[model samples]
Target: MADALITLEAVSKRFGTVEAVRASSFSIADGEFFTMLGPSGCGKTTTLRMIAGFELPSGGRILLRGEDVTEVPPNRRPVNMVFQHYALFPHMSVLDNVAFGLKLKKVPKQERRRRALEMLEVVALDGLEQRKPQQLSGGQQQRVALARALINNPAALLLDEPLGALDVKLRRALQLELKRVQSETGTTFVYVTHDQEEALAMSDRIAVMNHGVVDQIGTPREIYEHPTTPFVADFVGSLNALEVVIDEVVGDSVVCRFGEVGRVVAPAPHGASSGSTWRIAVRPERVTIGTEQVAFDGGSRLSGTLQQVVYLGMLTQYHVDTPAGRVVSHRMNDEAGLSLETGAEVHVGWAADHTSVLGPASS
Candidate 1:
């Protein structure tokens, strides 16, 4: 926190009857790839706009490197924003587009051109400096926009769904390129996106927002492996959520009543008590296929009827209807899995460590 380059202290933004962003407080470290990730209308883009000084918070403060800039105008803030549109001048050459901000600053023409060319090389657009925005590919134009933003040398770069306009393959390619450029430049990046995979792939830390509030913030691995809330568990990846009642606590685990799932073992989280109800979450990859007579190694097991099997080359997804509930299992598509099909009776088991237990889902 001491090294945070940007900090939001109880920031709130409202428009008439609706609050677009609640009192969100978080910090992005110096040279960190921090992301605000959520679904559409979750205020992620609004938060980015606020950081870039495009939206003024109705309450609280916005800090940049320990200085309060809560009331700073967009032009005065030490930040720049790149949007999905890439907003390049249609008639200007690529170099001029990248150097437009410098020209406005009255920076010497030669120096501005040098910096613009350097940034273009950084973004792998060296050969297209003379081309117009319409002359280059979508990805190239995006790189030009990134070059334009970075050339200003802002304290932080705010990106609002910058890859949203590109096709899937181009988006994926540019995600890596952006990551590489960030690493090379060591500039603080606060990116906004609704795509979970994009956030997980690019961010050093991610703040997961929902309904105008941050549900959780953590590294991708931490969020995926140890989600503390049901929304985070369900949003960050595909997983099964089951309603169960705690039967008892044994050693370091809890025995849960899964109705027809029989007695099941789950990791005992704090605040859990015997006879209490909870939501059980497990990833499809964590559930293993087992036989009726086979005993699993310290985990929950259930019997089910295979309802569907989808073979996706690398992995196979099995939809099973168990007495307790329907669950999905993901297994590597190896030679042995070739025989699996719908209508077959199967046993599924998941390790307690791989399970996440949360409060009951809201009504």
Candidate 2:
């Protein structure tokens, strides 16, 4: 925790009557790839802008490396940003664009050129220094933008949806490139994006934000596997949420008494109370859609009518309607799944370990 390079204590941002970011508290360690991930209007970009000195928090202090930098100007802060649009000057060549920051700082002509070329080479954009932004491809232009930002050697790099403009294949490629850049330089990166896949693929730690508040912050595995809230469980991946009332608490496990679905057993989340309304969340991959009932006791099972079947090449998804209403389950395209068909009666069951008891479904 002492290695936290950026610390936000009780940070809040408001625009008139609308609250953009709540009193959020979190920290980013030195050299860590931290991401602020959420949907549009979730205040993820707002948080990044605050840290980059583009916007000041309405309240709370912002600290960098144990120093209060709340009042620091954007240029004075030890940080640089790569904008979503690349923000490069079309008139300038790649070399001049990369060296623009150094020129602003009054770096010597020779040294600035040397550093700019070194950065261009680092980003694999060598030999294209003479080309203007309009002359370069989208990916090439992005690399130039990165080189320009990194040439300054800031303590941390802030990226605001840097890959939003690229195509799918190009975005995937740049995700790898960005990860490689972060690893090679070992510079702390604070990236903001609404893409969950990008965050899962690139970030060392992700802060899932919603309604201007940090919903959850953890490693990719932790965020994907042990989600603390239904929003997180549903947002991170495909989930089958079933509403059930809790019947009894047996040690660490809870027996949920579903209306027409019958008894189900699953691990209880912390602070779950007996006889309370809870939801059983199971991933699509964990659900098994079988024509007949599988002999698995001490587990949860539901019988439903298979309504539709979607062929996804590697896997087939079956939509079923049970007493708990409509639910979707995933199955591989193997022998066990070859006979799956719509309008067939099937039994969907999951092991206790695979089902998570998320208390109370959101309205």
Candidate 3:
């Protein structure tokens, strides 16, 4: 955090009786693509608004490049925001729309137009500068908005689900475009989105928020592979949670029993104790299913009956009914086990390192 660009120290926000954000703390590094990701009502948008000076925090402070800006107005702060709705003026051409900010600052007409055209090239919209907002496609309009924001040369760019309005295919494409623009401009991006995939694909680091709390922050791989909380594990990706009772602890591993099937040895989690029951979570893609028993060194295994096979274009999903409960496994469509029929007996296995011991199972 040596070159921290934006810092939130114990930030909290309230809307009358409801607490929207609570004691959230984190920092965005200079020129980094930092994302705030979570489901609706998770207070991510509120946090972004607070940083953009649109909403004030009820407690704590916000810093921009080491200077406290908790009370600064949006126009006075060195930041700009892009909304899901691109908010372009219908009467203006793309070039005019992009140069509007500069016009407001009384920048020379020629200079603003030159900078605006340069930004259009940066966003890959140089050829469409003369088109009105309504004449362009959704993605093109989005780039115009981006160019408009970047034309001002803000220290940080705040985006609140700017791709939320695009179709899945277009959204996926824009995720990369946004990352590229941020990289080329070297402008710090604090993007807010509820889409886990978008956050995972476009972010340098992500802060997963839940019910007003910033649960965890890490790289996409770290967050997906080693989630620190049950909410983080469940919300970020597909997880299969199995309730198991701890039988014993041996060094760095723990023996646990699930249902009447068998025991499993998993890497010992912090605070694990014998006889206590907890839910162990594993991502669907990490679990493998096979008709014949396959030994997985340093892993857990279970026997189950194949309940269903779902064919998704790029991958296949196998649902198996086990003694403990139902578990699902995902594999590429070309994987060998896709031929397994429903009702066939199958073995489910995953490495102990893939298992995450969550909070104690409900009574």
For every model shown, what is its TM-score relative to the native structure?
0.95, 0.92, 0.96
- Which runs of model 1 end up more than 4 angstroms from their true locations? 257-263, 292-296, 335-338, 361-363
Give the local distance difference test score of model 1: 0.88
Instruction: Identify the superior model by TM-score, candidate 1 or candidate 3.
Output: 3
- Tens digits of lDDT, candidate 1, 156-266: 999999999889999999999999999999999999998999999999999999988998999998888878888899899899888877889888888875555555687
Summing lDDT over every window of 10 consecutive residues in candidate 1, give the lowest-scoring window: 289-298
For each candidate, the alpha-carbon lDDT, in order, equals: 0.88, 0.87, 0.91
lDDT of 2 by residue, 172-264 (tens): 999999999889989899999988899999999999999999999999888887777877887887888878767788888888754655456
Instruction: Flag regions of model 3 displaced more than 4 Å.
Output: 258-261
Instruction: Give the per-residue lDDT digits (tens) of candidate 3, residues 144-239.
Output: 999999998999999999999999999999999999999999999999999999999999999999999999999999899888888999999898
The prediction achieving the highest TM-score against the true structure is: 3
Best by lDDT: 3
Clashing pairs in 2: none
- Angstrom error at residue 168, model 2: 1.5
